[model samples]
Target chain A: MPKRYVSIWFRYLATDLHSLCQPQLKSIPFVLRSPSHGRMLITSSNAIAESKGVCQGMVLADARAIIPELQVLDDRPDLKEKLLTKLAEWCICFSPIVAIDLPDGLLLDASGCTHLWGGDQNYVNDIGKKLHARGYDAKVVIADTIGVAWGTARFNRKYQVVSTNDHLSILQTLPPEALRLENETVERLHKLGLHKIQQIIKAPRASLRRRFGQDIITKLNRAIGTEIETIVPIMPVEPYQERLPCIEPIATRVGIEIVLEELLKTLCGRLTNEQLGLRTSILKCYRIDGKIEQVDIVTSRPSHNIKHLFQLFELKLQNIDPGLGIELFLLEAPRVEDHLPSQEKMWEGSVGLEDVRLAELLDRLGNKIGTQSIHRYLPDEHYWPERSVKLANSLQEKPIISWRVDEPRPVQLLHTPEPIEVTAPIPDYPPMLFIYKGKEHRIVHADGPERIEQEWWLQQGQHRDYYRVEDEEGNRYWLFRLGHYHDKSYKWFLHGFFA
Target chain B: MVVSKADIFKGLQTDLLRLQGLKSVNNCELNNFLGPIASAFPNHSFPLGVIHELISHRQEEVAATSGFVTVLLSMIMGASGTSIWISASRNVFPIALKAFGVDPDRFIFIDLKKEKDVVWAMDEALKCGAVSAVVGEIGEIDFKTSRRLQLGVEHSGVTGFIVRKASRNIGTIASVSRWKISSLPSEKSDRLPGIGFPKWKVELSKIRNGKPGTWDVKWFDGKFFPTHVPIDTLVASDQWHKKKTG
Candidate 1:
């Protein structure tokens, strides 16, 4: 069956955030500019601003020139993307497959979802009404092809639900830009007096190809129902899950063991065939007495070995309560990764990430503690000690950035720096004595202050001048003075304990 | 292989005491650890398939305990299998393990926020026979938790290390051995610009079938060497000292 695609466009997406967040900006004429950077072009304009001839890509200077009292605020692309992703996730209720169409639109695969709430037209009206009620201006359109839905949603005056068979006739009335061509291509087409899609469709394909390359023809075909275009669904159609139901409830350990073995055989076989391995698996036992118990095990590395996974479940078997006996067993893999093909060693036992023994051991350790408890860190290229390290993604991933041993780092770094009282005769020199948590320590061995400025662009924070100080009693402390000495806000803080 | 009743009686004395919980636990295997530290045991090796408890009362003592555990871990992880180190407070730096002759990558580090999770992870790590050993830095280990850990290692033929921080009860647990390690001021070469080899005073407070003793050892040139200081001379200093005096 031909896929039914729905495209919803937030016409004032960039400006809508300010309207939603500020509320007062809804009716006022406003434009978006860089919040912290030098003044520049206008990214977007509110409906009121647009009515007054202010539009996106207009120079901030020109917008100000047009409307002297117009308000211009930061156009936070990061915040906009975050909001767009959140909006797409919200639209998952309508259709399981929802993907953001770059800056402002959303694509939804609504093939079988039209009959759920109502018919296709009612579904569009329902979504549009709901979004408009939420202070958003949304234009909804449904077509057999993504290109038609995308184009009609933006250019059409009303909500359009074009049938797959008639998509070509309906799309031919729209402008050439609706074909998703670059501005220069659209303008070049307009220069040749080919203003509409019908003109392009009627024009010779060979001549169009010669003028604007093959982009226009391909896009035009995609906009209609003639050509196929694939849309990558954001979420998978189904999660990895397997279940076994028994007519008779199992109470004995041996019985449960048999069921578990059967489940593992199937799960592992499927995973192996797919070249996939699970990092986390959840086993649910549904008892005849309406009681449910679950036990989950996490692995440091992805694995599908039947015996190893069974052993992990075996450890958890005792914890599962067979209240009136369990009648159903459900196994689900929440986290899985591709088991990439590699050269296997002749020996049964191999070292490192690919080692089955290591993965089994780590799985047990991770299951008992919780996978989040395990961590490995790699050096990051930053002069600031705190920013110099990052959590390593996996055990196999080698650190591209090596540790900076030229400068000593503390063994134990405090989660937050603790302020300490420091006294010295010379302002620029290291502290002669520092009182930390009501205890005074006389510094015996001290290193020079290494000034590290905070990366202000990331986050604004005080600069630090670090000193490695060893107390008279052999206790080493990492102390840093905040900001420049001339500033009255300069203070000392203990950051870490050296090994 | 001669079955002498007298020799058996003498051997069973410690084994009987261990079985009754007076000592640590039963010795399931005769495989001793590597280096000079192993000679301090009765069979010239640390007992396998049991949990060894190490207590460090001071913050600096934790460093010594880390070094001591790293050295033993290298021996226990000889040739095969993986090791995991679980800690409640993440203080052990991975890069520092290289200095103690342990490849940081060979072990998995589990840092838990709650002390309970640390124990749970240790128990799980211990149960997996594929793992060679596990080291947990927790504040306390109850008698029941330790018993479960002992049973886990016994069934899997894995070794476990329990690093008890300050403020823990020095009461009895199911571990086969109890140790206390304190920094002994690393040896400094006369003409060197930096500090020399790491030195630690390792005290065996409790051993199942082995005698209890204290010895100062040095990790020099990637090996353990017993210092000239005799074991008995360091009798006043032990994990039990603070509790007994205070």
Candidate 2:
């Protein structure tokens, strides 16, 4: 099969961008200038400035002399590359493979994509019209090869599609510069009176190589379809992505659900075949009003179950507005992991975190109430009560060490200890009575003075003397004293309550 | 040979209990854990796969209730299964579950910001057959929401416990039982200097087709031990301590 390519040449890219940002700049003659070799040079000019004899590469002073009232704007060094890359991304609706052809153009590998828009002619015309609508003056051309398409879009008067059989005939009529050769090589050819590409192609290959080197011949061969060219698409194609274009805009909730189920079925089927699962996925709805609404879902573990994935997405379907109806739907799985098929168990009741149903339930819960709310704790080797436990990263994580059960820890621990007024016999003794929140509790039974020094490696602070006390009402409290008992500024805090 | 009046009355009471949807004691695993408390239940066995409400008005009572519920979860989950604990603001120390013979890693904690989200997560967890139990700490729950949770557990067979903390209103709910647990002074053996093992006054305030009773129980050796003593003896001890201190 013959390869087809489309080249989009932005004739006035920089000036058009400036005009689009400021509408008043559209009717005036302006030029974008940047410093080069300590002198300001015109990098690009609007059509009005070019018509008035102010062209790129001219000194700013010279251009001003030609048109005194020319509007001068500072040009960013990477403006052209940024603009072309953005345009290439926007051109993804036409073809999935679009690459930036440096300086002022984009090249799209439109081999199998033109048929979607009816034909190559309509495809090229559609790109030009859309770009014009966006206030960019672009000349789009489609041909059998990239070189031919690029040359015709920039140098030719008419932007037309060239048939596969007429590649050599079209090259024969174009100037030698259309072959995308160095300026010196084109100048040498012009001095030798070889004006058209026909003369260069008829010349002996060895002699042309000796005189002009191999660059011209290589570029010439690429244009005539004897050599192959590949494009690096701006957006890498996702391995697990499905697209559904609607003939009529869909607005109903049922329609969206149908689309989601269809996409999920196809995606999960592919994943199941390869023994893989998706951990995260995003659904993008392209509305008719030129806005995109997106919702994403994440699973606790890798999953390829169609029903489970559909249910996870269903919880978020209400977030999508579908304003003015949606015209296209795209589902992409950006993160996937290798998932082995679960073996069939002999017993019917499989109760554990490893159960697939459990993971599905957790995924639904996590999605509904932010994923941060769900946590599993594992013991950490720290003496401080607050540092005794840490959150588990994954469901399958096991604790490395057993919990410290020898000490009598409180069942309920406060995030921060509350200050309490204690009346005690000083010098390492439990409080006889403590007042908390305007209530007084008389300690009938007390244990105490279990001094725990601060972990100097982690922080610097006063050591705590803890005590377990039982009040008159049989309520047990864990209290702590900061600093030494002899210190004049000792303070008491109620940390926790025992069961 | 005719049946006596007492035997006839006993048979009629059993029939009435059975008609109230309470099954007889058939599972021996729960018989020893509840001990005398099991007799207060209609079937003389602790019910499984149903919602139980635990009410607490004080912060200390909440701790005692949490400990009691955790012990029940440990028994229900056994050694391999997992459970979920949902609350709006969680304060239960995860390591404390290990003291009750439960592996702390086997439970998942969900701390949400709204009561509605807590109830929703509890319902979802109850409907999941993979989990053995779900514990939710919520402030209030209406009859409709409790019925929905009961329905969820009916199919999945996952037990549920709702710990109501600082609840202002005590409305009727559709749970199988309502319990109130408060801390009780532990018995000191021979004038021990330190506090003893956690003791709680377990009260069954409401039970469908069952007796309502209170018992003093202590947790030691990873199980419940009934420490039933008369209230008069406790008051008498209190007076003696006051006299000595005075």
TM-score of chain A of each: 0.57, 0.58
- List the global CA lDDT of all models: 0.77, 0.89
Estimate the overall C-alpha local distance difference test score of candidate 2: 0.89
Distance (Å) between predicted and true CA of A274, model 1?
5.9
Residue-wise C-alpha lDDT for candidate 2, range A1-499, written one tens digit per residue: 6689999999899999999999999999999999999999999999999999999999999999989999999999899998888888889899988999988999999989988999988988899999999999999989998888988888887658887777778878888888888899999999999998889889998999999998987988888878887888897444799999999999999999999999998999999998999999999999999999999999988899999999999999999999889999999999999999988888868788777788899899999998898999999998888888999998889999988887888899999999999999767878899999999999988887778888899989998889999998889999999998776878899999999
Query: Across residues A378-424, which tens digit of lDDT does each residue of candidate 1 receive?
Result: 66787776667677777777678655556666655676889999986
| Native-referenced Cα lDDT, model 1 | 0.77
Candidate 1: pairs in clash: none
Clashing pairs in 2: none
Model 2 chain B: worst 10 consecutive residues (lDDT sum): B227-236
Best by DockQ: 2
Query: What DockQ, between 0 and 1, does each candidate earn?
Result: 0.21, 0.60
